[model samples]
Target: MKKINEITEILGDDTSYYLDHVSKKIPKERLQIPGPESVDNFRESDRSPQVLKNLAQLYNHGNLGGTGYINILPIDQGIEHSAAFSFYKNQDYFDPENIVKLAVEAGCNGVASTFGALALHSRKYAHKIPFVVKINHNELLTYPNKYDQISYGTVKEAWNLGATAIGATIYFGSKQSNRQIQEIAEAFEEAHQLGMATILWCYTRNSEFKTDSDDYHSAADLTGQANHIGVTIKADIIKQKLPTNNFGFREVDFAKYDEEMYESLTTDHPIDLCRLQVANCYMGKIGLINSGGGSKGESDYKEAVRTAIINKRAGGSGLIMGRKAFQRPLKEGVDILESVQSVYLNDKITVA
Candidate 1:
């Protein structure tokens, strides 16, 4: 409901800031959207008819208004970030049912959560909204915090729970990366066979990563490779962090690039950096859904809008927001979700 100018006014005039940086890059022309025929081609080539039907239904749902864009509500953080940390700020979400209710009320295209969170209420809400069952998680309670993710449920179990899609996280740069890749590849193969779409939470987590340097774990270069791997595994959708930098290539011995490569491959602008991530997802063949990290104080809504704008402008699919949506009062959560969806539905916000 807010115009781009109004949002920029709230963000002040730090032109280099993400909000201002992205606003200046909004495409003058309308976004070149893929039609239903393209969706059909995508589904037929990589997914089953049942999976395609389910995805189409999700695309057509809620405030998305049949735009074929994603607006997913993911709540697997309770397992990933710990329940106490995840729900303490908003105790109502401690009840799994409230989590489902929030997504349904917000008119999200789909909801992604842990097995127990979605399975317990499958009979009541699964039919109402597409359920993206997160089959793997890395609990934060482990000592020393190993950078790895493990599966918690089988794809068959996910199918039985009426899952429209299945999601898993891969700590792409860790020592356990190979094993995680092999395990998830097998899981995704079975999920596609069972007529369930696959989503990969492709993130970079290297213990040896130099945090002080530009080539950190979350750099676009590393996360972009993570997305490429997700697509190689035949994941129908790739979920990644919105890239902030593109220096990961410098961290490893096998890869090297000059300063000019950054200008040629990426830009200082936030949306341009994010586009490099989308470009890695088979150039949009595999949809790119960005993770909505943690909330940022009173600017949560403003941040959400800014992220949505950047993702859309970067030619990514949509947002799979978690904490920023559920860690607030129900009304506020719904408002945030709707605001993000508006960025996709509004024609004024277009991809370059």
Candidate 2:
């Protein structure tokens, strides 16, 4: 897709409209992010104009609808699981370049990764695809902590390294969630200022809500709330785990979710749930995308694609898939990506 000067186009010389819109839309609390002053002075020098230009390429491929579903292939397994557990068993899965290639070849909206991986491949394949630099991460293999750290190159640095968007994970239920919110807000604001978009991984954890899907209302409400927070903070695309029928909220009635009720929302199998999610996004007035959990079997992966397509048809923004694509052999991964793209963009499906 051709790139347009969206920044200038959106806010023309009549700056009052931009100022008024921003002031009314974003809450003051939402805008309360610590600026560069909070960071040590030593790191400030790198936040240069030249650096931001390079980073904008990572997330913005300038495709899809001007603002469409962002089918992102995220492979941060090395930080989430043991390196060997994630990639060593199949060395083919360890190469970041292979993952990026799969995303591009398969027609993904973009690929998200840590700085090292993006820096290595952006220049060689910059024209081939768009990239998103994951600015914050937490390793599960490490000693457990209340929350994760932003152990990455700065957002400005990531743009300089050639990223179009930036990804940040926030554990909403964590004890340190407030700090994470502040951190992400700062990055989100900065990224937008530089004419780039932001994708937020809004996960819920360390709360009363368990991982079980059968819980019904509680889980749905929890995920919905997390998504709400992301939207409230002005995320362009908010990503969350696929919610189960379970509801984490007591007021929700799980048994009421019958086939007739489901059919009322849309024709897709999970259309009811997807519609509910879309409703939540509509209520919050933002785009919601679901994440592809870890690697799964073929059937499971296909089902995931089916679910994603359902979400899209039900008014979803797109997907943020990871291990499912990257864990496979590179070629197979690329094929899986293409299949997903075909399903998402073209609405072609063979799955039952």
Q: Residue 64 of candidate 2: its Cα lDDT?
A: 39
- Model 1, span 321-347: residue lDDT tens: 988888888898998888888777767
Model 2 C-alpha lDDT per residue in residues 25-125, reported as the tens digit of each score: 22223221211121121134334453344333432342332234456788877776657888864676567787677777666767788888888878886
* TM-score of every model versus the real structure: 0.91, 0.71
Which regions in candidate 2 have their CA more than 4 angstroms from the true location?
1-67, 144-151, 211-218, 251-269, 283-285, 347-352
Flag clash pairs in model 1. none
The stretch of ten residues in a row with the least summed lDDT in candidate 1 is 23-32
Candidate 2 has a TM-score of: 0.71
Model 1: residues >4 Å from true position, as ranges?
A: 1-38, 41-44, 251-253, 256-260
Please estimate how well model 1 matches the true structure, expressed as its whole-model Cα lDDT: 0.79
